[model samples]
Target: MLFYNKNILIVGLGLMGASLGQALIKRRQSKDDFKVLGYARKQQTVDIALDNCIIDQGSSDLESMAKQADIIVLCVPMLSIESSLQAIKPFLKDQVILTDVGSVKDEVIRASKKVFGNMPNYFVPGHPIAGAEKSGVMAANSELYDCHQVILTPDIYTDKIALNTIESIWKFVGAHVVEMNVEHHDHVLAATSHLPHLLAFSLVNTLNHRSENREIFHYAAGGFRDFTRIAASETTMWHDIFKCNKDALLEVLNSFTADLDILKEAISSNDEQTIKSVLSEAKTAREYFTEVLQARSNK
Candidate 1:
C-alpha cells in the first residue's frame, strides 16, 4: 500500500506510466519496492523503457508481468480500460490493489466490478489532472505530476484501507490527492477538463475551415497558442474519454452551444453592449478562478 517493498506494475508505458516509473525511482523507495514493471504492445517501447531506466522490467507480454506485481496500475486510455481489465484478470493476484488513471469513472467502475467479479473493495478509481499535449514514452518527465491534483473516486464497495493506501502512493509522487464520488468526479471534470479539450479541438477545427488569410495562423500569439495547445494531445485518448462520459459531456456541450448561439446572435445584431457585458463577466470569472488557484498554491 505504501509502495515500499511492493512490486508496482504499470500497464501501457506511455507518458503517464513512464513518468510514474521515474517518480518512484526518484523517491526514497527502493527500485525493488516500487519496481516499475510494465507491458507495452510494442517491443520497441519495452526495450526503450528498460534502456532509459524508466522501468525495471517490461515486455510485450501482459500475463507474465501481471503475475509478479503487488499493485497493478492501469494507465491505458479509458476505452482500453475494459479490455485491459479483462485481459489481465486471468493473471491478477488476489492480494493486488488494482487501480486506473481513467478520465471517466462510472463505466470504468461498473466494468471493473464485473471484471474483478464484483469485488470493488480491491479497486481504486483515480484520475490525475496532469499530462502533456505530447504523449508516448519519449515525452515523459519525472515531474509531470508535481503539485498536480489527483482525484480518487471511492464508492460504496471501495475499501477505506485500499483508498488510503493509494492516497499515500499519489502523495509520494507529489500529487495533492482529493476524494470524490464517481458522478461528481465525472461531472466536474466534464466542465473543467473534458469540455475545454472538446472546445479546443472544435476551435482549432473551426479555424482550419475558415476562409482566413494563409498567414493568419502564423501570426498567433502566446495566448492564442496556449489556448489551443492541448488540442494536440492524444486524439485516441480524448476520443475514448468523450465516449465513456458521453452523457455528462453532452449535457455540458449542449449548454455551451446554447451560450455560443446567444453570442453569435448578439454579434450579428451588432449588440455591442451585450458583447461587452459578456466579455466583462468572463474576465471577472477568470480572475475569481485564478485567485482561488493561487490561494491553493500558496497553501
Candidate 2:
C-alpha cells in the first residue's frame, strides 16, 4: 500500500485538489518516486492547472484517469462525493485506495456505502481541515496544508494498509494527521467550522437585504469585514455542506439560538451583572484559546 511509484489522481482540480497536486508535484520533483495527475469537469480548468504546473498530467475524462490511478483523492463538493464515487467505482483498480478532502465525514461514509453497497476495503474517508475563502485552480498554493490538521475516519471495513498509505501521503505534504470516528468528526466540525460559516453567511445575508444595506456596508468596520470574510466563499459548496450535515448543524444551531435568546433577554432587561459575567467569561475563553494555539506553534 506504499504510495511510492504510484499514480495519484486528484479528481476535481479546484482549490483543494490543485493545491494538493501542487504540493505533491513539488515534492516528487526531488524524489521522483510518484506522479501527480489531475482531473476536472472542464477542459479549461485542466488547461489552467497544467499551465500552473499543479499536476504532471491533466484531463477532463474521469474514467480514463480513474483507470490509471493507483490512488484517488476526491476533492469535489460534499454533494458531489456520491456522484464521483459512482462514476469512479467501476474503473478503480483492485488495490487502488480511495480518499477524499470533504469537510463532512458522515455524508461521505453514507455515500460510499450507497455507491459500493458496502464500504470498500481500500476506501479511507479523510478531511483536511485546511482551505481558503478563495477557491478554484488559480487560488492553488503548495503550502495550503502546511502545519494544518488532516482528519481520517476509518471504520472496521477500512484496510489498514490503505489507511497507513493515506496517512503517509498527508504527512508528505507537511500536514499533522489525526484520526477520529465519523460521528465525532462530524459533530466537532458542526460546532466549530460549520456554525461559524453559517453565522457569517446569515449575518451578511441579513444585512444585504436591509433597506439601508448600502449605508450599512459603507459604515462597516474592519472587524465586521474580517468576521464576514468567509461569507465570500463559493455558495454552492457551502449550500451542499449545510444540507449534507443538516442534523449535526441543526443541533449546534439550536444550542446557539438558545444562548442568543438569553443574551437578548439580558440586554432588554439591562442586566449589567449578567452581561458583564458573560462577556468576561468569553474574553477569558478567547485568551485561553490564544495561549493554546501559541503553545502548539511553539512545540
Candidate 3:
C-alpha cells in the first residue's frame, strides 16, 4: 500500500478524517508501518478516536503533532483551511506531502500556497467526491469511499510525483481517481454536486414548515428519501462549500433559476406536452449519468 511506509497526520478528527483512518486500517495499514495521528479540538474526541482505533495517537496541537508526519491531510471546514494552513506553515518539513478534503479547491489551493511558501512537489488539492449524510467521528466508517470517485485538481505548480503518490493513496482504498483543473472542478461541481445539495437543503426546509406536515411525512418515499438524503449530510461542510464557492455557485444558481422559471411557466400554462417532453428528456439524461456511474463502479 502507498501508506505503508508513511506517517499520516489527519488534521481534525471529524467524520471524513476518522473515515479515512478506518479505511486505512481496514486496508491493513499498520500503525508502525504507517503512523496515523489525529488532531482534534476536544479531548473527548481524542479519546473517542483512540478507542475506535481511528488513529495511533491524538493531539490538540498542530505543530507538535505535525512535525512527525510524512503526509498531512486537512479535513477541516473550508473557513478554517487558511488559518490551519497558516498555523502549520512555519514548521512544515520540506518535501512533506499535503492534501485536503475540502469541496472548494481553488481557494484552498491559493490559501495553502500563500500560507506555506515554496510548497513541495507533493502538495495536491484533492476531494474524494464521496461522503455520508452523517457528521462526527462516532458516525465514521471504513467503507465510505468504496468504489467512489476521488477528484484531484492539479495545477501547473503541482508536483507530478506528488500527484501520482496521492492518486495511488486513493486507489489503494478502492477509489477511481481523476484529474481536473481547479476552476473546472469548482464550476462542474457547482452544477452536479453543489447545486443538488443546495436544492436538497431548500426542499427539506420548505417541506418541514408546511401546514400539512402529516401528509408530507406520510408520503415520504423513494423520491422524497433520495431527495432529502443528502440534505441530512454535515451542514458545516456544506455550508463552507456554499460560502467558499459563492461566486461560482451563484452563477450556476442563476442559470438553474431561469430553467426552473421556464418549467414553472409551462406547468402554469397547463402545457401537457411541454411537461411530458421535459420530464422524458430528464429521465433520458439521468439514464446516461447512471450508465457512466455504473461504468466507473465496475472498474
Instruction: State the C-alpha lDDT per candidate.
Output: 0.86, 0.91, 0.85
Expressed as tens digits, the lDDT of each residue in 1-299 for candidate 2 is: 27888999999998999999999878664546898889999999999999997988879999889999999999999999999999998898988998999999999989988998888889899999988979999999999998889999998878999999999999899898999999999999999899999999999889889999878988999977976797988887899899989999999999999998998999999999989988999999999999988886676
Best by TM-score: 2
* RMSD (Cα, Å) of model 2: 1.3
| Stretches > 4 Å off in candidate 2 | 29-31
lDDT of 1 at 125: 90
Q: Please list the residue runs of candidate 1 whose C-alpha ends up more than 4 Å from where it truly belongs after superposition.
A: 117-119
- Candidate 1 TM-score versus the reference: 0.94
Model 1 Cα shift for residue 37 (angstroms):
1.1
Candidate 1 lDDT tens digits, 1-299: 46677778899889998888778778754545557788899999988888887888898999999999878889999888889999988887878888889899887887876776674687899999999978998887889878899999987878777787788888888899998988999999999889999988987788778788456589888866976797899988999989989999999999999999999999999999989999999999999999989987886
TM-score for each of the candidates? 0.94, 0.97, 0.94
Q: All candidates: CA RMSD in angstroms?
A: 1.7, 1.3, 1.8
> Highest lDDT among the candidates is held by which one?
2
Clashing pairs in 1: none
